[model samples]
Target: MGEPFYITTAISYPNGKPHIGHAYEAIAADVIARFQRAMGRDVRFQTGTDEHGLKMMQKARDLGITPKQLCDGMSSYFIAMCDNLDVSYDVFIRTTEERHHTASQELWRRLEANGDLYLDRYEGWYSVRDEAFYDESELVAGEGGDKLSPQGTPVEWTVEESWFFRLSKYAEPLLKLYAEQPDFIQPDGRRNEVLRFVEGGLRDLSVSRTSFDWGVKVPGSDGHVMYVWVDALTNYITGLGFPDETGDFANYWPANIHLIGKDIVRFHTVYWPAILMSAGLALPRQVFGHGFLLNRGQKESKSLGNVTDPLELAERFGVDPLRYFLMREVAFGQDGSYSPEAIVTRCNAELANSYGNLVQRVLSMIFKNMDGTLETFSSAEADDVLLATVFAACRDELPREFAAMNFSGGIDAWMRGVFACNAYVDEQAPWTLRKTDPDRMRAVLLTLFMAIRDLTIAIAPVVPTSASKVLDQLGIPADERSYAALTGADWYMARVATGEKLGAPVPAFPRLELPEDAA
Candidate 1:
């Protein structure tokens, strides 16, 4: 056990089936959680479907199904997506659950008791597509001269009796929060965007809706359901067993980070923090707004007919390969595009050719040339240098970059270590040395064996399945695969003491071929 670490992905609104964007957020959050665990943190990761809102209600009506039926069916797909993608979430929360309703109502009562809530009327531009309300100033003109939200979603004017939260009162406090804790909202660009939005001034937000009842009911108020954002944001605490304010809630109430898409930054960073403040709860440590995943340079959409099913991609290319490609191709805070060709090329070049081939070759030589035996060997300056390079990448560079959420940059550093190993193998030519100088050949192969273990452990958080296969073949114990084990000087001697020998190796990441029709 280690210090408690809590991370969450934005609850996906399940008005539709899971999309690439949903998979992207879920996978990225899982990577963070896995990485934290590898770094010796006791991590709690939560993700789920936000099943209540006007969108879900209207979508259910259009499909002629009950809202609960729609949520039950649609949320299953998201759960499947997370499972299929190997997202190791600890909790999967559904807002429709009775416990979540209780948690949300208690949060509402706290806000009311703080004198921040009041009955009011809301008449403004709202985007059901975005599940957000916008001021008239935030609207942009569409091609047809219609008003659109900043996200370009169509907005509709609505008037309803509602309950409002005193968001206007939190502007100064929030600005102070941002100024004092610069990392409170991640990616300097997103923080600056929020700074500008808050500087302009905050408005009291409608916290309850009277139009329809597809949300948590406002306590002691009839015909008023808590606003969808209010309910949705509460899911983070609800998963921790809030309102009870004990056990997990007391331990993890202030989430380490809320990993969400950029479109929802205002809600998480602005609205979410204010609500928590009013309730006298600790604010989350950070809110990270990650950029979208695009389909070959264009945003995927139904109208464009370019929507991709992430599971299909995972099936085409192996799951580990797809996972590797995403973290390698995308800069964490910036938009990145992907295609069938991109997936095949990136995975084959990096996972298969670089790291995977390194593992296969090193282990194969140990099985053949070294008689599958383990022994202590002397290392030359070159072997020492190669091991140093790999160790630094695994221990120093990757961990530092990952701590700052720089996935691609960390992978880049790891690749340099891989490149160094390949160059070492080519220079050493252990195959030729096997006939001429058997002892040096044994040393070379064994040195590579050491390097392989470190590399595999460092990357396991990203591609867990394939990494595990390689580790299993290497005879590394399951419990010793974490980053903490990377520096153990006695692990090799301990293994040698066991007289464990290598078996013939299998390719952990076989090369992927693009389908003929994929183009």
Candidate 2:
């Protein structure tokens, strides 16, 4: 708790409306950030728009407006998406911000002072879609013999005077870093890909582009803008008040984690670290490249007309279910498909039936049988041994999974307890016990309520809205809602007071119905 935890999502390229892909990244990062904060850490979570790029410049021209105006409108859409998804980011940065300009120039000066940067005539294939330069070999020939970047973006041959970073000299250093840290990059597959890339051969990187003027200006260089990647990546440090070299920088610099999409792993794991080393700064602790969200089993693309708007999805099916499906359907580091059907199936079965049903049913029993009051069993242990075991498993395993970045694993572990709670309710049949042995029924219903309370708290990060609703239905006090307040206090911080009547029962996750079109 004493140490600071800094986490960030790669800034979105605000050239268009944000899609479900953007929401996926933001929600994943938010889940972890919320969990760390709930654990009592000083957490700084940042996400923003990468407004300085050739794509944005071209998009602005197409719309017949200044790039800043275009970015201003588009960035608002992204911010709205984050808000709609309940993403808990503390800082939102725009690369066009004045602070970013100073930070980019300062970072450049540091690289220059370290002798890692120099002016050079650059010739390469560049992808405006990617805002990255590619080597000749990295371009693939299409059936029509047109060259495309490795990720299938169209490339153009370009030549200009540019400032270059001596990235070639850092290949060996990066290898040593991978060897020593072993976790500098993540998902094992992505780390190996980066290793193979730097092993294949490292080359000098162009740091400033003379051909573009809609970006951060290159210090002391006329008519030049710093490369979009360089400016965009520095937002991580700029958000921490870098160049000032004190305060947030002194505490939160050297980000604990950079959560990014896999397509940009090379930039974060290789190029970013080399830039940091050149500046005589600490590299981020981890770079995790998570997978993309697919639509109808294919990558979402504008041409395909299948790009799903995140806000629209939230409007149709509420926020917590969408957030839950984003994590629950996908393994943290692998591609996963999204559809209305999948979302409905998961929500109806897991949220509505298992977890949601458990909360409403347990509380309903306590209210109907004990007049909304509860009393703890006097035993040193729970009467239902199996339910106790499941609670213990969730109590011990959910935190461990979150720490390892296995978000799906954490959800699974929490759901395991949820299912167990439901099973205990059915098998014990507290309703029948109420008539036969009313006092024993009180103990059983209270135990079930406690399990519901703890399990809901365990999953609050992933499905925040529903979890909060569940706690409110249980009348959990506000101060005891955080993970620390619950798990930190004696007796695991009981929330349902002894003989205190809970409020009227309300459905947490209402059952969803299939769209008429789906039928």
Q: lDDT of all the models against the reference?
A: 0.93, 0.86
* Cα error, candidate 2, residue 289 (Å): 0.2
Write down the TM-score of every candidate: 0.99, 0.97
Best by TM-score: 1
Model 1, global lDDT: 0.93
Per-model tally of clashing residue pairs = 0, 0
> Where does candidate 1 clash, by residue pair?
none
